[model samples]
Target: MSSPLFTSVHVGGRQATHRVVMAPMTRARSTQPGDVPNAMNARYYSQRASAALIVTEATQVSPQGKGYSFTPGIYSPEQIAGWRLVTEAVHAEGGRIFAQLWHVGRMSHADFHNGDLPVAPSAVAFEGKIWKVDPATGKGEMVDCPTPRALDRDEIRDIVSDFRRAARNAIDAGFDGVEIHGANGYLVDQFLRTTSNVRTDEYGGSRENRLRFLKELVCEVAAEVGANRTAIRLAPFLTARGMACPDILPTILEAVEFLEAQQVAYVHLVEADWDDAPQFTEEFRRQVRARFRGTIIVAGNYDVERANWVLQHGYADLVAFGRPFVANPDLPARLAQGLPIADFDPATLFGGQDHGYTDYSPMQQAA
Candidate 1:
């Protein structure tokens, strides 16, 4: 019997050879100062091009949008050029790739942005430490996030335009499509959650208004890249790093309704973190399948058995693997053969060299 995970499916008008996706995991290995993608980064992505679809690490749209040190960006000409090399390499492997456009919102420290204060939907500070780049040693440093300024009406408009421009730039960088980074309590998620957005304006105070920015962003970006080539990611029930969305089901249902109305390519959901927390319930999964009309992609601590189970039960159309794909470059082949998976070293997950990034041997290659 053939696994649905290995079956071909169409996403945004492009036919994917399989249903296994490489979920975007930030490696923090970008070249310094300008935050440009380099040959090493290109090789890393190219090596994992075997996935049916590869969503690159979250790339910030602008400098102020940055949160972590050494992560790449897509807002400048140099950054675009650097990403071009990565996209070209993946294309050479006959794989589809999408750029996860991101902004950290208030989840950043000034040290990461050259002493500029981080911005969010409201003037709220998260009770967590943000990782920053040391100006002197160019190393990762833990810094406290400062209070952010609430984006006014005009500022909100500019942010929406930034997303549109970023989507256009992703096309120029040779990505098959763009995935709006609405997950993990980023800018879009900040606005979506009432805990972060305290405004009484049109962008807040009601479920419809809170989701307005995301809807507009999707509509605008889809216009630039076409609805078939646009996707969005959301951490629907995530509550990490001082982020929480009350009434998760209703909020998610509302989001699904909005996405269905927009006719997006797909909605990627990070149902839960890998940790043992009850983030996504079976009822929620069924509700998503019932409400969402397009392709559904689910990520979070998923192995081959779980991936097959979800697809077989119609919970999701695809399963994205994060750490597994990072450690095992040939993750699809390993799953296909039911090979024992390798464990990823958490210590080398962030800013390491090629040791853990690209040195994982495939089952056949190792044998």
Candidate 2:
């Protein structure tokens, strides 16, 4: 039987030929010094152009928004020119792509900030290691994050403006749309959770207050780039970044209400992937659909069968395959033909040449 995943769907004005989206996964393969996208990045994305949508890995909106080394940015003219190659390549293969705009916030080290502290919603530490490129060795490695300085109210507005500028820059770089990286305990997620945001100001305290930062950021971004071309990713139960809270679900629903009010293109729900991770109930899915009116996309370790089930059940409009896309560039075809898929090499997953980058071809192509 043909899966519903292979059916066409409309995301905003673009017509996606398949429902399988290649979710954004960061591979630190950009050129150094400027951290710009290059032809190699273009080749990698263009190869996987079969997916209905390709969300580019989390891109830093500004120098201060950067969390790790070698990740691409959309802030500079050079970066925009560089990303043009990737977008053109994807378009050449008839693929749709979106830039996942990111600001790491407290999940950052001081090395990228000229020895200054990283900025966040609060002066809290994330309590884990973040990936950074070694200045001396010029290699990517895990490094501890320092205690971040909280963003002043004025500074908060500036950061939101940065997101708006990034969205405009992304359009110039040839992206079809932009996905605000509000998930994974990043800048916006920090403000959403009570554990990270303990502020008593207008930007924090209550759920609506915590939702202010994200709301303002998305609103400004959508204003700059029409709401039809704007999207946001949210992780309701992800505590890996020490962002666990009791009220996170309600806050997510509240944010969805605003997002629907803005008529955003879609809301990407990132659930836990591992077997040990908590699974959200079907009731939650119904709740999300009730709140958001546009499209709902679901990610986190989804396979063809499970993705088909959700799409058939009217829970999600699209299914994003992360690691599978990492390994199988022809992921949609592989699912359609029920062909054997390859497993990715984790060691070469980040900061590598062509070994694990673009070398992985389809089973037929390899044979």
Candidate 3:
């Protein structure tokens, strides 16, 4: 039998031609000053339109939501106009695209907020680096994140409104839909984990409390845009960014139930792929499948065979390839033909020019 990847699937009330999804990847190439998407970004995504769905890189919902340098935003009118170009480009190529709205929370440095500390559910700080451009040198570098100021009850509500507005802005900018980035070690993820959130308020302490922020944000976004056009990304067992919680698996399972009840189009799970990363067991997969009967999109370091295997096993409805699509603009076509692909230059990945961004020729052009 032929691979199910090529089969049409209904998503967000639209029929996507294939089950190959382009995962939201952080390619920090947007224009600076305003953090707006540009023609280069439009070309970059449109080139990979063969994927059934393309989730844009994590876009800041507001200036305060920004964590990295050069990442795009959806808050300003200029930003919206910029994104419209990207959406139009992808649509012209007959592709479906969703904006991945983001709020980095404490995963940010003070420089972005005029030396003000970033806000989170708790004051805890993760032991990691965040992208920032040096004020003196104007060169981008990863800097240590300080202990963020915890958000008060009223502030939390404001952030929720920000997410809802971002969803509306995405629709106005001509996106097919929007996906709330509740995964990784960002804002929503911070609130979900016990280690990061230790407040005794209604949003902290117990598991249900930890899940409150995510639930509220999702509800706002889904209400702004129908659940059919809303989705979420979750990393259940991620530990790289100090996300290893003893009860994280069950917490995510419960979150999935909430998302399922909301009728979200899909839940994108970011699997462990780095060296010695914690394993997402088949048992866990089964549990997720049982709870979330809606579409499941799994992303790891999956190749063609692995992607097809998961789809066949009822583990995932779609597989997302990140780095592969960087060098192989026509990744779906290459995968369909079992063709070889080139590796992307690692150095040119973040805050770069057109060299590694869109210069990767298709197979025919390279030949």
Which segments of candidate 3 are over 4 A away from where they belong?
none
Candidate 3 residue lDDT tens string, 37-76: 9999999999988788999999999988989999999999
lDDT of 2: 0.90
> Model 2 over residues 1-367: C-alpha lDDT tens digits?
7789988999746887789998989998999789899999999999999888899999999999999888998899999999999999999998889999999999888899999999988997668678987778877789889889999999999989899999999999889999999898899999999999989899889998999999998899999989989999999988777788789999998999999999998899999886788787799998988988789999988888899999998999999989998889999988988889899999988897889999998778877
CA error at residue 277 for candidate 3, angstroms: 0.4
Q: Candidate 1, overall lDDT?
A: 0.85
Which digits, one per residue and each the tens of the lDDT, describe model 1 over residues 25-122? 99898887688988888888888888888999999988878888888999889999999999999889877899999988998887665677788888
Candidate 2 clashes between residue pairs 3 or more apart in a chain or in different chains: none
User: Candidate 3, clashing residue pairs?
Assistant: none
Better of 1 and 3 by TM-score: 3
